[model samples]
Target chain A: DVKVTQSSRYLVKRTGEKVFLECVQDMDHENMFWYRQDPGLGLRLIYFSYDVKMKEKGDIPEGYSVSREKKERFSLILESASTNQTSMYLCASTLRGGQGPKEQYFGPGTRLTVT
Target chain B: DQQVKQNSPSLSVQEGRISILNCDYTNSMFDYFLWYKKYPAEGPTFLISISSIKDKNEDGRFTVFLNKSAKHLSLHIVPSQPGDSAVYFCAAMTSGSARQLTFGSGTQLTVLP
Candidate 1:
């Protein structure tokens, strides 16, 4: 089974504080992604990394940044947490290319609250 | 503009009955569609998927039907149990697009006993 684990299930941070959310996948997938889920907005991609040390901005990458130092781990960083940045963050990984569909496996999710 | 749309915000169905969740997409380039189930405080899980070449794909009690001409798809769960109650999201992606998926605003499903 493919397992994706997040660093924190719930977190509370003060405004202007830096927040870091970690994710590790055991499946050794080459592609990793960060997404935030909001009410009525669904899941919007924040950032994605296709390989180590490579990152691409997603639709909602204004307030968030990502890091991929290693293949199996990806991290999301909030330079300065704000109330509007509080949301459920999710991490997912998938194989780069294969014969079948590229289905992403997601982590449990981290709920961050900026106070 | 929302590329994918789930018209129904919520759906209620009695146990042992069929529950249908609908989704529509505006992008004609999308060739792959997927359905995901998410519970409160948890990330979405892959449920089923269908390609543009095929109209339907089934896995156990969950079946996803795709209509390329209409740019629409539906997920059918027969005899839905209480455990099936969750938010269902429909996602679409084009092949060779770095595997980025465009998801719809999910539909909350409630299964009543």
Candidate 2:
């Protein structure tokens, strides 16, 4: 079974504080992604990394950044947490090469509350 | 602009009945569609997927139907049990787009006993 684990299940941060969310996948997938789920907004991609040290901005990358120093691990960083940034963050990974759709496996998720 | 849309914010169905959830997409480039189930405080899980080449795909009690001409799709859960209740999300992606999927606002499904 593919397993994706996140560093924390829940977190609370003050405004202007830096927050870091970590994710690790055991399946050795080449592609990793970060997404935030908000009420009525669904899941919006924040950032994605296809290779080590390579990252691309997603639709909602303005307040978030990502890091992929190694293949199996990915990290999401909030330069300064704000009230508007409080939402559930998710990490997903998928294999690189495939003819059809590559379904992404997601971590349990990190619920961050910015106060 | 929302490429994918799940218009129904919520749906309620009695147990042992069929629950149909609908989704629509505006992007013609999308050739693959998927459905995901998510619970409160948990990440969404892959439920089923259908390719554009085929109009229907089924797995046990779950069946996904795709209509390319209308740019629409629906998921049918037959004999839906209480356990099947969750937020269902519709997602789509083009084959050439680095496997990035565009997701729709989810529909909350409730199965009453």
Error of 2 at B77 (Å): 0.4
Going through the candidates in order, what fraction of the true interface contacts does each contain?
0.57, 0.63
- After superposing candidate 1 on the true structure, give the runs of residues whose Cα lies further than 4 Å from its correct spot: none
Residue-wise C-alpha lDDT for candidate 2, range A8-79, written one tens digit per residue: 999999999999999999998999999999989899999999999999999999988889999999999999
Q: What C-alpha lDDT does candidate 1 achieve relative to the native structure?
A: 0.94
**Candidate 1 local lDDT, A1-115, one digit each (tens):** 8899999999999999999999999998999999999989899999999999999999999978889999999999999999999899999999998755688999999999999
lDDT of 1 at A96: 95
lDDT of 1 by residue, B29-80 (tens): 9999999999998889999999999999999999999988898999999989
Residue pairs clashing in model 1 are: none
Predictions in order: lDDT: 0.94, 0.96
Model 2, residue B31: what's the lDDT?
A: 97
* DockQ of all predictions against the true structure, Cα-based: 0.77, 0.82
Question: Least lDDT summed over 10 consecutive residues: which range in candidate 1 chain B?
Answer: B93-102
